[model samples]
Target: MKAVLERKSEEALNNNSSIWRNKQFLLLIWGTSVSNLTFSIFTMALPIMIYELTRSAFAMGTMRAIEFLPNLLLAVFIGVLVDRFNRKKVLLSSVGLQMVMILTIIVLLLTSQLQLWHLYVLGFILYTSAYMFGNAYHSVLPLIVDKEQLTSANSVISFLYTFVGLIGPALAGMVLLVLNNIYGLTITAFGLLVLLLFISLLKLPFIKKEEDQKKTSMIEEMKEGWYSLIENKELWNLTIMVLLSNITSAATLSVFIFFALDVMNVIETKLGIILASTAIGGLVAATVAKKMTRWFTRGQLFIWSLAIQSLGYFLLFFSLDWYWLVAGMFCNGLSGGLMNIHYFTLRQETTPNHLLGRVAGTSSMLMKLAVPFAFFGVGALAEFIPVHFIFLGSAIGTALIIVYLIRTPVVYMR
Candidate 1:
């Protein structure tokens, strides 16, 4: 009992130390918060826009597939660029490009001249820019805080993400309604808010990479990054785990709207509420993740959270009612939030600083490579098989991953 009490005291003290009190960390969090909110709103709004405009699930799925295409194609190269150049500049350029894309989208929508293809092109551009910025942001995080506070810092970031998710989707639905009522002012408003976020982010200091012993060609840099995974058995194992997790998540997300509208017979407004419930659950989980990490090993947390997520998916298969669907989504969100915090901290702590960007990008590419497959497969399956079976398959696949993790020691690394 005394030892447990002492350990808690130590953790509390560490959390309150000067490292956590840094102004930069606060600024980073605020900047990321703004970006996250805007991005989430854009994500939720885009699918609605596509669905409304084309009224085709295949079209929506195709657009989503395009959005992920950049992750599969450009991630590794972008990671190489991030490592070779200044990360801050890479981030700024990406944000600036995103702003341009959003502005173009708003203009097209306002002019009543927007076509489906226009959205496709803009969505691709936006996601490409997002991929670049995301890689830099993830890579730079470990540099901002001490190793001991990594889980706590990651938890706070994940908490902000969940908070944004909770607000952004509902706000997006509201904004769309407002736009319909006010004759397109809401899109302008959203664009202006995004511009403000980009402006505020300019105040952040540029993060400089530590000098390396040898600078190499772009191909060499990429090769070095690839070598980190190939040479380290532990990283390789974790990379595969992340890949499988992403597949399950993408499969579930791709078919979610179908399940909500068809199987559950939910209204759009209620759909937003259901999605928000998941975010609320995610917010709660993220808030407690730091505390939970003290009691459970990161591996233990990941495996258990995944198992819970699989159960959530299984529940979705059994329950076609609105309330049950919402409950399952909520549980899935909780597990996802915890898994994100744990996995991100693990990556930051274990990866070398010089290779951070490349490593992150490579990992992202690997994980997201399965997304297009999920999008296409879900769309294909929905035409023939019942949507419930898709959920069942996803649950079974996730359970298999958990079993694989249980047999492996991948999560035991610090």
Candidate 2:
């Protein structure tokens, strides 16, 4: 009788349109907005700072590789941990660890004792926590919202992210002008502190697993996640598409600072403005993403999104001016915003509650498997090859994958 009542209650919430009023949802979005805004500043500044410090492209590339290495090495295991542990504990612990890393970086920077190796080790740990937090973050949403509202909830989150992207670079650029990396990261540390408070206030719904399932070993749990991911054709195909696209993106983005600093000869402020302008496209796409999924079949939207990104890469490849590069980033942002909304919604809607952590982890690991290699290789190759050529290769690679997806009939598009 209690189970029936709970089901009816959930159904009512699903049918209603007051997701905006959801206290847990609102807190999560607001807190995320703060952290993302600050992190955007840190991301834009880090590569430039490294280049200024070491003057070595290889070092920069290595740092980028280190940042994402956790996605490949630890994401799956951490996903299992998120599934097995209390989510609130996971969120607080991850954010807390991230704050510590940021504070450490800031201290080193101020003392003029910061080194490349410090960035490497600290970056690895920070992003590892980030990935853990990310898995737990995504896993928690389904618990708080109705299944039917997944798209709406994810769209809202994506919009906040895109909105931050739109403004974050410019803000970071301004902060860089008045302050420095140390000051910028000070803001990030403060934001994480606030994020911890909001996380502590969350009252997530409880999920009960079967006694047998709970008793399974971690290895068995991981295998269960891998099998669950492969069993869903649409989800598996989407994961492959993202995986390939990330490789192309990594190739272009990893060297873009060199492209901008050397080829474009733009200053930091201008570069920030250029990157921030690109987010306009994403912001627009985020607003319309839910409607787009409804207007187009899931497969159709996926194709269109990737096509837009490929076009953006072509623009970058042929860029005659900074404006052209901005146009390229705009396309990338638009497609990314669209793809992520549907992709996340599908994952949330399709996967079982008990396995959300593991599946999210496994899928993320698979998506990022090639990224560190791409970053390191591009960094090494940039020493001999022109950065613009890398852009061309990315465009070509992206175009080929789109064709492959279209031609492959075994993968269902609808």
Candidate 3:
């Protein structure tokens, strides 16, 4: 009795203390920052590599379309797996799988056997693993931190990653210009290796399951997740809102590489600068996100963020020069950064820790349902329409989504 009481007392104290003092949380952030840095670099390099290989805007869109398929197909099952199994092990395994895929990519590159098809297949596997890691990682955060600290914890994590983003793209550009895609990817592989080490050292508390409860089947578990999501009016509505928003984002982003290379006539280094500009907005959002919450409800933030994003897209629509495109990218990143912190915090705060994996997976699956088609459609359209028109279309779509959101009870949510 005394030991249990003392432990509880200690935990409460830790929970109330500063987030930086939490060793496990810090470790998680450090590891994730390294991985995000590499992923950012990979993101910059992959499109250029694909473009160089195929030189078709539609091909890049095809790659983007393929990347989201796993989310649509496998996320629900992966959610069940995360909730039932050890989350740390799931995270580690997912990271390891991605590393293997990256290594395979490196091998193909070195041997001069890399093909567009190879990227299509490997990218699917890699992103599937990334989805698994994301589910487990989201589930793990609630386990490690207190409820009151969620927003702040999320803010800190976002800030670090955005900071990484601020530099990672520019660095990737320089790396690509000077060395080659292989060297940039080699850095990514190394960061993942280091991430494995950090994750291994994390000592997460085990979740206690009720012994009297009967074991549920996987199908039943998935249904529970689905119900949990749809049953929540705010979450379900926001999920729909995000679904629309993602489509617009996908459409614009699908042809951005082409916009840079063909339309703007920029080289790798300048392209990186434009891409990295988004991170500056992200950095600003991360810095101010928590403070802004005190002044506005979460719902207000959502609407405003979407509004800002719409403005950003409109900027892109009129961007006759690279700097104008840079401005648009910054707004897009800023809105994304602002919304993500609140979005994740709200989900974690509302869902039971046990259901976090399932809910996250299902919601993600739902949000991603239309993205692949959007990618394909946008890719096809890029061949006919000017890229700026896609941005114009996306901006209009986002405005309509905002109108839809304004009519919902979502605006009333705190």
Candidate 4:
């Protein structure tokens, strides 16, 4: 009898038009926005700070690889943990841990004890917590928002994310120039503290799982999740596309700053503005995504999104001029923003709740599994070849990926 009413309630929520007023959903968006805005600043500054301290492109790429490597190693366990525990508790804990790490780093920086190795160890731990938080975050979305309201919820989140990205980097650059990396990170850490408070206030609906399913061994639970993700035709198609695209993006971006430094002679302070330009395009895309998705078929939108990313990167192969490079980033950001919102909605709408954390984690793991390798590979290759040449190769690789996806009959389109 309770299950019957629960189903009826879910159906009504799906048909309702007031998702914007969902307090829990809004809090979720606010929490992520707070973190993302600060993260953009800290991470953008981290790499540049590394470059300043060590002057090694390899070191910077290695830091990025540190951020990614956890996904490969811990994704399976993270999915299980999110599903087994109270996700809200897990999320708060993760964010809290992240804040501790950031604050510790700030302390280390001020004391002058920070070193390259310190960053490596800190990044590994910080990103591991972040990955866990991400699984819970994804799981929380479908729990709070109606299935039909996903697009609207996602659009707002996406807009907040990209709009902040558009501004955060530029702000970080100015901050870095005026005060230093340490001061900039202090501000970033403060934002995380606020985010922690917001997460605590969120009122999420409980998601129940069967007793028998709960009794399964962790390995078995992971296998169940993996199988479910791969077996879904649409999920598999989307995951495969992202996995391929991430390979080239990782490779290209690994060396992008080096190219700017070596070829374009771009100053570190001004580079923040350049990085921020991508956000402008992404922010614009988030603004229009709801309208655009309405006009286009899901499958077509997916393919077009990938094509735009490819076009954007391809142009970067020869963009020595700063404006030319900004134009390229704009296209890439626009498509990236579109695909992210659509992908979130599609996954939530399609996948079952029991498997949401697992599939989301697994897909994320698979998508990023090759990224570390690409970062390391591009970093090494840049020593022998021109960075722009590597960008060209990445462009070619992205184009090939697009062609394959276009021909393979994307099954995920709405």
Q: Residue 21 deviation, candidate 4, in Å?
A: 1.5
Residue 137 in candidate 3, Cα distance off native in Å: 0.6
**Candidate 4 local distance difference test against the native:** 0.80
* Cα-based lDDT at residue 401, candidate 3: 92
What TM-score would each prediction reach against the true structure?
Answer: 0.82, 0.84, 0.84, 0.84
Consecutive 10-residue window with the lowest summed lDDT within model 1: 180-189
Better of 2 and 3 by TM-score: 2
Give the higher-TM-score candidate: 1 or 2. 2
Write down the lDDT of every candidate, Cα atoms only: 0.75, 0.84, 0.87, 0.80
- Could you tell me which 10 consecutive residues in candidate 3 have the lowest summed lDDT? 1-10
Evaluate model 2: give its TM-score: 0.84
Which number leads on lDDT?
3
Clashing pairs in 1: none
Write model 2 residue lDDT over 339-412, tens digit each, in one string.
88889988988898678899999999998898878988999998998888898898889888788777654235
Q: Across residues 1-414, which tens digit of lDDT does each residue of candidate 4 receive?
A: 346437635754664667666777878888788878878778788898689789999999789767767789899889888878888999999999888888888888889888888888888889999889888888888777766677877888888877776677677777778977877888888888888888999876655666654588889889988998888777687888888888887887888887777789888766766777788888888888888866788788888888888788877887858777877778878888888888888888888877788888888888878877787788898899778887678678777777777766463456
TM-score (C-alpha, index-matched) for candidate 4: 0.84
Tell me how far candidate 2 lies from the true structure as C-alpha RMSD in angstroms: 3.7
RMSD to the true structure for each prediction, in A, is: 5.9, 3.7, 3.9, 3.6
Return the TM-score for candidate 1, rounded to 2 decimals. Answer: 0.82
